[model samples]
Target: MKNPFRLPRRASLSRPWRWLVPLLLVLLFLAVLIWLPWQARQMEANERQEQLIADTLWVEQTLRFELARSEEALAVLGADLVSKPPTPEQLQARLNQMFKNGHELRRVLWLGADGAVLAHHGLELPPAGLAKVGRETLEMARLTRAGRYTEPYGASAHAPGMVDYYLPLFKRGEYAGSLVASYSLKVLLDETVPWWFAQDNDLALLDRDDHPIAERADGGPGRGIYTHRRALDLPGSSIVLATDSVKGTPRLLPNLLVGSVIVLALGLLLSLMTLWRHISRTLAAEAALRQQMAFRTAMENSLLTGLRARDLEGRVTYVNKAFCQMVGLSAEELVGKKPPMPYWAPEAMKDYEERFAGVLAGTITPQFETVFQRSDGVRVPVLVFEAPLVDSRGRQTGWMSSILDITDRKRA
Candidate 1:
């Protein structure tokens, strides 16, 4: 007969799909790991660009403010000269005071209405290059009759980067002389750009032609530099203030940290995947074992043979439903009962006890005939088969008995 106790075969795991899932997960994790650091660097570069632009604007505003202050000072002096023309002694004294206070101004001049130098300060002899101005620039000042700044130019043989500030003086509605102030580009940058600002970056004041008038000696922008430029709004001038980060845009340590975090996350994900695989296999095995146990239980319940088990000391440990029916008792009443069991006939109690004692001593019988009294006091002849109940370690821990009632066969 086919063994009905055999369990159904468990479904096999899909090995390719099983490994492919984690493989795809690993690939995704690696993609994110690769992308994170690049993203961080790009963001850092953008932030650096923004910061450079802001610094350029700040430098532009600072230069504008300083130039305005200097222009106002020249306006005051021009007012004094127009209201009452001073003596040569008074002019020299006032100019000396102004030069002492304003270090950015390299020279000062009083220009006649025809652009001829009337008086000058700061240099014993003015360079030949400083004698004339562009007629168009001079005419603009004369027409505006207001303070204006000239485009940056080589002011003297000694100073290549100087600009002239002009304040046209008008006395009684007639054009008078003009008060001119020459500003040194180097001196202006020194007074305008902060010490801290120049430490981390290279700053430069560029003329209209993009020629650097004054520059800080922080190394030029190499690879990965962020640069920004803003115009310094001065009258009749197109001066640009520019800044650049000398050490490049993205910082190294932060990018390294971001990469480290991504690596750790990938490692953690791999660990979780490993743990999940182990758990999945374990659950599959448990399900298979449970199914096997359920099949065995169903086969045992359907058996016609009576099954009984006794521990090493001859105490009944287990009895199946068929055994209870054969003894005319419930399993609860028969299981855990000792030798001289309730179903043993009163006259055969001594014989049954001796047989049970031999069974506890490891004696086994393949088959024997016995008589058991039912609950109604009727005697039933039964054929019994006995065997050792061995555990997984091959140790005999108990006895198992199979019994078949044969009253009808005996009568026939």
Candidate 2:
């Protein structure tokens, strides 16, 4: 004989599905939630590193441009020195004026074709002289009949370091003389680098050997998390501009967020399992009625969307976990609350009133948009879907709302 107590075939097939599908969904959701934050953090780190590289290139170009400008200005002086034949006293006055304008330049000198100093400005002429100290660049200038920058020199225990720029003077294919401009690396950085940029990074001028020539660190040394190096394309020098940013890497998730997710997930899993066991034990007593209520409650609690149920009298009869968390309030503070809800945005009061009126008049717009203010005063945009709440007897009892926080969707 067919057993009178046996479950229907369809019901037996669906039994595992009732619990298993939700369990798999929860696990999948957890994996996605963890991955999204980690991926975002990685992107943020790469963006910061890229930004540092771009800014370092900009500073390098700025320094190069300033030096090139000083080189051009010296050429104009050399032309006058060759053609007009200004007196030593007059040339000295002009060099002083140039010094006032070219902040990067430490000195200026005029060298005859025979390598004798004609007239100079800013500090006494060095005892060793340019011919012996920076012979390669000076010779290159004479042979090419063009211009060149000397290798940086004089950074010893007794003297300060400087770079020399030569603007060769040629008259009818014959080398006449050259105008030489000197640069202090320290002054070049101080005058060329912007204050705001320097304040956020440690900038160092490095030689080919990676030795620090000069440095500017307004906000102290970097944490080494974000850094970049760019070379200044000067022929006689392999000076690199290196920057270390003060900013650090972004965190993947906050402690509060991780803790909350863990606690909520554990609680949900435990509640579902407990309810499942209770239903298993009482299935023969009131299978239809108890099974339906248990399934509905567990499903509602597991949702990420906020759920709300109201009695026909406009009183809040129930609220789910997501709703309380969405508004930054506890469930006890939200349940049984009347109109003028704490979560309602004051600026959207009229909109809320009209919607509440519709709920009381036995009708509701199937779906609509609204804003809710969190307890912290942050506004959250939401899309709400409303339907008629039905009783076990299939009679309409109240209004049910499924609220989805659409802040991310709206932002996108």
Candidate 3:
């Protein structure tokens, strides 16, 4: 009889190609899930550092501007004091005029030829020993005789909370005793320090000696002005400002284990899906084959026969209808079950296993025949043919086998 079993006529689809597509997609999905979040956190930290640098530069500029303005106002007042040594009434008038100009001078001092407090404004005339302390203020004013802004002097007898600006007065280019303007730190804060209050910042003006002579802020020791070197010349005072730091979100390892598991799950799912599609199409094709095979069986089924189809593992995957009928078992009962060694003809088991192993190893193609035993203890002959089952990449996976019952030819 012509061979009843045959290969599918046209390549309906490449089964191996179908399975590989999903495997690659699953790997791609895992790569994206892990990489995106880590990059975002690195970007946020860099932005915070830049903003802190900008705020510090703003404070340093404001301090320099206010100091320059104070020195200029003191120079104008100093010129008048030395040009005229006036009556007591005239000295009081000049002091009142300076105060009315909205400057924060707490005391005005006039030094004599021998550095004595010859006349002063805004101080009680102290007794002899007490009034002698104004000599230090005269010594500071002596430095400005050459005409430049003098540094701050610590509080003298009459004024304790103050910084001084001294200027030498001249008439006809002749040397004269100096005029000194004493500034109240409180008035300086009231005029210039309010502008720094926004953005939670505190500003302090310190003397060259690092004593805090003026402050526009209250509370907290956030005071480390020297920590930022740009504020160094603003001397004695430290400026500190802070904002609530942006809280970082918790980082979960979204892509580490989760990505790997997801990829694996997808791979398994794709594999299963491919397997299901494969099995489904194979079953449909097999059903069509069964119809054609049924007619051949009807012509040949009268004599009892044995059939077995094995994979490369020597486990049976299919059985013909005639063989199923002879064993009195359904095809499901025989599939995936191993054939008994004793039922096989002598020496067939070794040959079958070796051939199946060769097919699995890709060392040989598979197609052969051997005797088989039926459920009724009948020795019957069968023919089996196998082909290498592989992926599109041509890697061998398993084998597909078909069996034909050949008992009638043997019996006849």
Assess every candidate by TM-score. 0.73, 0.61, 0.42
lDDT of 1 by residue, 1-412 (tens): 1122244565555456766787787779778777767777798888878877888788788888887877887888788888987999999898888877777888888988777788888854345544355445667788998777778876344554777877888889999888878888878887778887777678777887788877763455423377778888888877888787776656534755776877788788778778878878876877787787777767777888988888898888877777788889987787777867889999878778778778867786668888999998999999999888888999988888999999898999
Q: How accurate is candidate 1 locally (lDDT)?
A: 0.77
Candidate 3's TM-score reads 0.42
Kindly list the per-residue Cα lDDT of model 3 for residues 1-412, writing each as its tens digit: 1232544455444467764786567656656554545654455445544443455455455545665555565566566555554677876876688676645657766655555666777644335522222444445445545433334444444443455544566566655666555667556555544443422344444554555555444433333321232442432223222222223333554347755665676677678678867876896787688678767666655544444555556666655666676555676667767635434555467775675567556665445667666656676666776566666998765555555667677778
Q: In model 1, what is the error at residue 371, expressed in angstroms?
A: 4.1
Worst 10 residues of 3 by lDDT: 236-245
lDDT of 2 at 267: 79
Better of 1 and 3 by TM-score: 1
Alpha carbon lDDT of each predicted model: 0.77, 0.80, 0.54
Q: Write the per-residue lDDT of candidate 2 for residues 10-96, one digit (tens) a residue.
A: 454237777788879877877776776788789989998998988998999999999887777787888887789888788778788
Model 3 clash count equals 2
How would the candidate models be sorted by lDDT, starting from the highest?
A: 2, 1, 3
Candidate 1 regions with alpha-carbon error over 4 angstroms: 1-47, 123-133, 155-160, 219-224, 251-261, 287-305, 309-379, 383-390, 393-398, 404-412
Clashing pairs in 2: none
Worst 10 residues of 2 by lDDT: 1-10
